[model samples]
Target: MEGTIVRRVIPSDNSCLFNAVGYIMEHDKHKAPELRQVIAATVASDPKKYSEAFLGKPNEEYCAWILNPEKWGGAIELSILAEYYGREIAAYDIQTTRCDLYGQGKNYQERVMLIYDGLHYDALAMSPSDGAPEEFDQTIFAVRNDRTLGPVEGLTLNLVKEQQRKRSYTDTANFTLRCGVCQIGVIGQKEAVQHAEATGHVNFQEYK
Candidate 1:
């Protein structure tokens, strides 16, 4: 437990990846959008490199979607950031205990942590009070690859789940309401449901 690293909980919005990257780099989640923009531009500039085969969408559309604040970030974004920052980003998949290293440098002087539950991502860093941060790549890969590495309190799993649940609810509320049967717009959930009932149109959509 003496050498255990403390994990910081980034906001559980869809932008969790960007927020995690921002936190690792600047200790500020507010920088997430800027980081997201940088990654978006990087992907945009090389569509063929991050093409549909790898990104699951056509390069141009994926580029646009990746920059959306409501969009989530994933391995593709993480790898780009590692390369852009010239620092290793180690991702630990908690369920599988899989540790993946990103970035090209060899010295491993600086590194940060990204924790992935099967569903969400969060940032981890050495607690300042715990002493100097190590070459995390070496610490995890070389020293403790066989063991689960984290603080005694664990990886903030409950916090991660709660944050994600709250974020999901908030995101759901942002959808625009429209009646499927009447094809008319409604102001909010109340009106949408009320309209559906009045028109006997059981189907409704939350569309932009």
Candidate 2:
């Protein structure tokens, strides 16, 4: 009765967060634009709730930033998407193997999983068994069902172990990046942010 839970790799098109959410919610990987619209519209409509201090930028500017397809999504976007879809989202981190549950206190009926390798997001699904194709994958699990939730968590931990064995996780704190514009090198995400803030260069590529 237990199924095989596996990681469904998503393309690194800067919208992997949206794509992974779409894959789990609708089985469609191309739902970035519409979901981005949802976030933009939601923020644009509620200025008081999503004020500049909360968003770390002006509401309008954050809205525009999120609407841009080239930008990446994080906790803010995950929380919004979880509320929008009315389901709890559990993101499993590769580096820490910690699960961050969004919408936990909201009493959502169902839950979905997303795997984070520090830099990119991917969907997690369960097939009937090993070697089963993704067409047979089940993305949603009942929140209150221990029978389902227990095994899913077990399998996800197994997958995380495999990924860690293969060194598939990124150490964002120590990873090196080079600005695509000026080719200047920076260490870690904080330094990369500082470089971007200082030079107005947004493009960066990770390098060994």
Best by lDDT: 2
lDDT of 1 by residue, 1-208 (tens): 3443555667655577887777777666777779878988998888778889989989888878777776667778888988887677877666455567777345444566777754456776654344454334122222133332334224434433444554422122244666666788776545654665577564555565
What C-alpha lDDT do the candidate models reach, one value each?
Answer: 0.63, 0.89
**Which residue pairs show backbone clashes in model 2?**
none
Q: Any runs in candidate 1 off by more than 4 Å, and if so which?
A: 1-3, 104-108, 128-208
- Indicate the residue-level lDDT of 194 in model 2: 82
Candidate 2, residues 1-208, lDDT tens digits: the string is: 4688888989977799999999999999999999999999999999999999899999999999998887889999999999999999999898888889988788888999999988889999998887888889999988654423766678888998788778777799999889999999999888987887688787788889
Error of 1 at 199 (Å): 21
Instruction: Look at candidate 1 and tell me the lDDT of residue 85.
Output: 76
Give the lowest summed-lDDT range of ten residues in model 2.
143-152
